[model samples]
Target: MAYSTTIRRRRRTRRIDRAGNPAAIGRWLLFVAGLVALMVVVGGITRLTESGLSIAYWKPVSGILPPLDAEAWQRTFAAYQATPEYRLVNRGMTLDEFKSIFWWEYVHRLLGRLIGLAYGFPLLVLWMRRRIPSGLKPRLLLIFLLGGAQGLLGWFMVKSGLVHEPQVSHYRLAAHLLLAILIFSLLLWTALDLLEPRHGSRQRRWRAMAMVLLLLVVVQIGLGALVAGLKAGYAFNTWPKMGEHWLPPELFALKPFWRNFFDNAIMVQFLHRLNAMLVAGWCLLIAVSTWRFEAPPRTIAAALALLLLIVGQIWLGIVTLVEGVPVAIAAAHQAGAVLVLALTLYFLHMNRRTAHHL
Candidate 1:
């Protein structure tokens, strides 16, 4: 009788360890992930529109309220005039034109603030009620810290343009974008970990492939950011070949040779194209391996879905480039990248969980 009682206690403990109020926590996480997606899309628009440097200040608290009166608007415009972008690029921009860019940056910053509040308040409530699983506390706290760092990193990127150049550094833009994607992926992975079932046999090879695919997707995103930063898409404006050549001649013409990878528009766009090919090839490998090994049904389905999304993403990217990276299509492509990353994380988390069960 005592042995049976101990067995029951252990089962109960395992159940508790799996999750504490998972339904509530998972829902919150999904909501935050959706918001992050919106932020990323809007951020892309802000960059494409060249509105990222309009505000000229990072007022985390007071900047919430946009210029209300005409006098206030003039003051805002005057501040922008002091920056190099105004003198070098937008010298003739009027107040109305200034507002057009101002709102995009404003919305981007507002969304960032909202995400912070949405995440923090609910987290506090859940923690007070003892609804968050103890094992998850540290992970959630780390995500919050990363979120804060992302905000500062964004300002750092903006500060670069404000000082001497009309454009932010491609490196800083890549860092900011990469960090945001990382936070979004982490939230998605944690939420799926909490909500999904934990019973299945693991495939070690498949697990390794999924992780590799995830890392490649992240690197591709960073490359895409660099392409956008350098406005590289507008230069080539062709697919399968960059302006009638398989490899553009001016790719490495920049001084110091290595500067071409980040600063040279031709080289940046070429690298992005090469990286996309690598990512697509990796996805194909994962799909074939999963099917050959006869992995779990969930794993197979995820692998197939990932393959489909990546194919579509590749198509979208080509179209976006062929058409000169139009705002609408480019934003959709950016959002698609996030979705691919989220799905990849889901696959990796599920694979690891299955291994743990085994």
Candidate 2:
């Protein structure tokens, strides 16, 4: 009983103030969220450049430094040459070309390592110092585990391409991308919860609306990932319609009907297009609702930000597809999805009531 009372007193002593953040933990999480967003952008670059399979190996520790010498470069290139991607897709590619792709994938992996360090190092220090809030301890641990799992899943996705297929499985690709988004969302949400313990409006209706919009955005993001995995954007380059018709003649050309949704490039692109419309419509509805009800200033600001993001994301997607998925536009389009998701998360947290305030 005495020990319990002492623990309660300790918790009470570490109170939060509106002007300040929670012992740098919330800020640290925000910084980690930024790194995850960068990782997503770099992942897009790695895929677009056909560089994902260039590395051909996953050395969690030793791969930190790139090939340092001529002999090292040659050995690394030789290992890549043994892969199915090199043999089937990039056959006869020169050493200089191999180096170009190798660097993108290397940087991608390096960012992952850096993110892990960025999150883990601070968490360890804070934990040892007993600065972390008791309510957030288990949540942080879970986030760390998810980060480790994401690394393993990334390698699993890469392994698929190192075999017979020159490209990774679209299913694995979508799963990998969604998992990254999940981690990012979790980080962002936790940070918000810590930073604003007394935040959020009392409007439960707006909370539901925000949640629905967030789900729509997440689903649309998954569809975009599927489109990328299937290389669907390169085909459907028309705006307002799909190449002279609202529906293509071969929309469902695959034998099994469901396979068309996953394996058929045309169908995948169509789904992505349709989902984007749904997401945009939902965002508009929520933005207008926030104005109609005269929500708090911060709430309206978050909604307005989300509204603008959806519009910009729609334009980016169209330009990317119409321009035949140019590397720069395509990378921006992928990055834009993360930005939209981040803003949506902010909007959701504005109205969400959680039990984990410190």
Highest TM-score model number:
2
lDDT of each: 0.87, 0.88
Candidate 1 residue lDDT tens string, 99-169: 99999999999999999999989888877766677778888999999999999999999999988778898
lDDT of 1 at 64: 88
After superposition, which runs of candidate 1 have C-alpha atoms over 4 Å from their true positions?
1-20, 197-201, 353-358
Best-fitting candidate, measured by lDDT?
2
Per-prediction RMSD in angstroms? 3.0, 3.1
Q: TM-score of predicted model 1?
A: 0.92
Candidate no. 2 TM-score:
0.94
Provide TM-scores for the models: 0.92, 0.94
Q: Please count the clashing residue pairs in each candidate, in the order shown.
A: 0, 0
lDDT, candidate 2, at 202: 79
